[model samples]
Target chain A: MAKYYQPEFECMALEDMRALQSEKLVKQVKRVYENVKYYRDLMDAKGVTPDDIKSIDDIHKLPFLTKADLRDAYPYGLLGTDLKNCVRIQSTSGTTGRRVVAFYTQADVDMWEDCCARAVTAVGGTNEDVCQVAYGYGLFTGGPGLNGGSHKVGCLTLPMSSGNTERQIQFMRDLHATILCCTPSYAAYIGETLKEMGLTPDDIDLKAGIFGAEPWTEEMRRDIEKSLGIKAYDIYGLTETSGPGVSFECEEQTGMHINEDHFYAEIIDPETGEVLPEGSKGELVFTSLDKEGFPLLRYRTRDICVLSRKKCSCGRTLIKMSKPMGRSDDMLIIRGVNVFPSQIETVLIKEGYSPNYLIEVDRVKNNDTLDVSVELSPEQFSDTVKDLAIKEKALADAIKTMLGINPKVHLVAPKTITRSEGKAVRVIDKRKLHD
Target chain B: MSVKQISVFIENKKGELAAATRYLANHNINLRALSIADTQDFGILRIICDDPKATETVLREGGYISTVTDVLAAEIEDKPGSMAAILEVLAEAHVIVEYTYAFLAPDGHAYMIFRVDDNAVASAALAGAGIKTANQEDLF
Candidate 1:
């Protein structure tokens, strides 16, 4: 039937899971309160103390942490352990503001790898599998995290960090890699390259893929599956929460099962910060239950999704978080209307266009303008300007129907858009510069 | 009969068109007839070149979005009503012309290239009307 990395915790009873969370939450709260002055001040300002939280239910009394708090803390302001104890550090891309730096001790690294190993195992990895990690290495956590997890699973780990697509395929075939790990977009690029090389999924030995570090739609999942001839699985994590193994998809693939014993999750109304019940879509908040190095409590993750504890065939009782519909921070307010890049991506994939696109939003003379340049598929390209214009109008109309506002769709030549190896940059808001 | 025409995507940027032409000139390619259809964002530069396949390959290598398409080419009598007569034939055959560009051949004849909705149907109608059509060899 179904499989799990840690069958004990993955199938634990609800009462026992809650009791474990309560014990770890109490210990983690005291660790952050005593060691991290930055969060200690936040707790002090909110009139909260270690004694204030007795059980997991008392979590709301703790001060909430946001990206702003993380920015203020910067390099080491949030370290819950001594400097000598921490052995490693991971960082976010920091495209917005200051980069969030997270530290990990030896034990913390073990725990993080254990979580990731659970991901590999949940996807059916074993000693016989060859795990190739194509995520970027260095300070980025994706490569190292999955590499460590593959090692723990006793699989042949190929630490081939991102880029050099031809080389990636070469090694994948030469070594018969069984499990591929990287961002979903990169996996798609590899698949595209395979076709360019006059090869198909039959040429390689890829059985399953673990993709994360960016948002991907269900349509994309199916596209990658067809291109690679492998079951594509989505893994979820942020650098702030131990990289790519905070939650992972099992064979069932309905949603990702969050490792609640290591991290307790809560959903809250973004506007009021009031906790929502199960199945209510809201901003996700997480608490590090057993992290010793960079312990954070009530950290607000700007992802909008719902939690489901429905019975799954995967035999895991872990709470499932729906594929984040879209990040709250990713929402764009154009002409007084809310838009997400994922919305446009959904329309593009549905219209049989390549997902490679560029969105330009500008404010012209007090009115907002939306322009989307999408790459035309080779099969859809027309020599006549009128025929191409007709295709552009049809795509614009479809997007307008979905978004309630019209977008100026420009049909670009095939393969003109720049592809990405990590997270793809899909939106450019010139209106911000005007503001 | 159909003639090969090369279409290049010219982005609406300063000196982009200049760069494309310079690349073609550097490769010893000559343009026989050219027309540009432009918008606020981008323009499509359609050219009947002496070497259509070579021109497309050179422009593509130079990073220009270029493609070769077949267009119906008719050798008209370099006079006033002769052009109107060809249009009447196309209209009667229900073949719509998306765009047309013309240039005088060195042999003292007027050649008009018509990008029609259906190239095969347009070529058949022009043949049925006893018009002198230019094949790919005639283009060179």
Candidate 2:
């Protein structure tokens, strides 16, 4: 049977939801225009004002906010509420360049937590269940967002962060964790570890899992489900908007239900920025309808996906967003962490190595392996294999420090990587993720 | 002085060793000794050829990565304890051998090549033990 955290909000009629969203958008626009000078200047430049946005229909008139804009307004430039009222801040786990920091007021946290609570409830989590939060803690929003939401659902929350798979399994077995929340990759790792320790899924008591913060295919979901003996769910969120739980999958795993009351989403043509109609695959853009500290209006997500209002078997009237097809940029997600080829290039240049390199990503035994083949500079190259191996280890360590994930580095002969006339094919992702 | 060995990196694929040997054979190069140091992905085919330059040139022209490395080579008696006695001296001198390979020469003796961390120190240790190292011409 289908369950809901907030039946009144999740099953609200289309007209009523639209009315609620319009009122929230109007209020949010005025709040940003009055307090945020950065957004106010953008609105003025686009010949838009708070008066122009009387309803959600005028959301198109607002200028779009891209990642570059967030970088430009780093720290507190886009904060809608005063710092005194801001209770917490979450940031993207980007090690290179600037990170997108999102501030949250108490009410913002409450609403975000409520959205997550709905996700947990939809997956049949309750106060009697022990929820294990294995997403990374600290700056990354996955752990804390779900942790807070699981607490709101009154579940016995396990605040265990990512890593230490052995200990995670021990606690899962000892404490009988009924619900698991983590990235899909880590969940897969835990499931693999569980079997390696001579324990089957029958030994554990988990019933469901909430996984997100990285894109995972349905094949991975089924694999995890079979291994962990749990129904795996996908949750969607961005640190810029809030965190994981901006939307969530219910009993019907077709797509994640967007918390439409809090976030008004639209699909836009990435090239032209024109709003695409419903069910069209394009760049996802979100407007925080009821945030206080950091309210982003029409923020471009750069994730290519579709939105549908098709009736769901789970009986929720909220619109659903299809799993993102792929990233519209050069960013690649390896082992549930965002990795940009430019980040690797930055490390290479900083280490006084040639910037020409090729990244080969492959999935072996349900784990993503990153192998980087870089051209050895003439000065760094040596006849001794020991010296070359040392250089490779040094470069690999530098890249790991930059990306927070280890990569196998191979120092090849100079001018080895194939160079083309146009944009170089720097990344060769062999993982057939979509298939 | 130690012998100069030509090392060609062979990717772990079928027909790679054949391709490397075919290039050397086409150039009329005779291999005095050859050994392969391999891992999962690739292997290093170390060879003491009749002509190191020609072997490297042919391999390079055939799109193979080849390098010339100096390694200590000593001709020992074909008896079992002879090679062990030479290694015992190097171990007593605290000289570490990175890798070693042996081949039975046509002259009824076993010639062993040792890639050591310090070639000079290994040479002195072998000389101290009355084992004279071979030069490139000696191998040919």
Highest TM-score, which number?
2
lDDT of 2 at A51: 97
Which candidate leads in DockQ? 2
Weakest ten-residue segment in model 2 chain A by summed lDDT: A376-385
In model 2, what is the error at residue A30, expressed in angstroms? 3.7
Residue pairs in collision within model 1: none
**Model 1 Cα lDDT, one tens digit per residue, A153-240:** 8889999999899999999999999999998878888898899999999999999999987666677788889889999999988777
Candidate 2 backbone collisions, by pair: none
- List residue ranges in candidate 1 displaced over 4 A: A331-435, B1-140
The prediction achieving the highest lDDT against the true structure is 2
Query: How good is the docking of model 2, by CAPRI class?
Result: incorrect
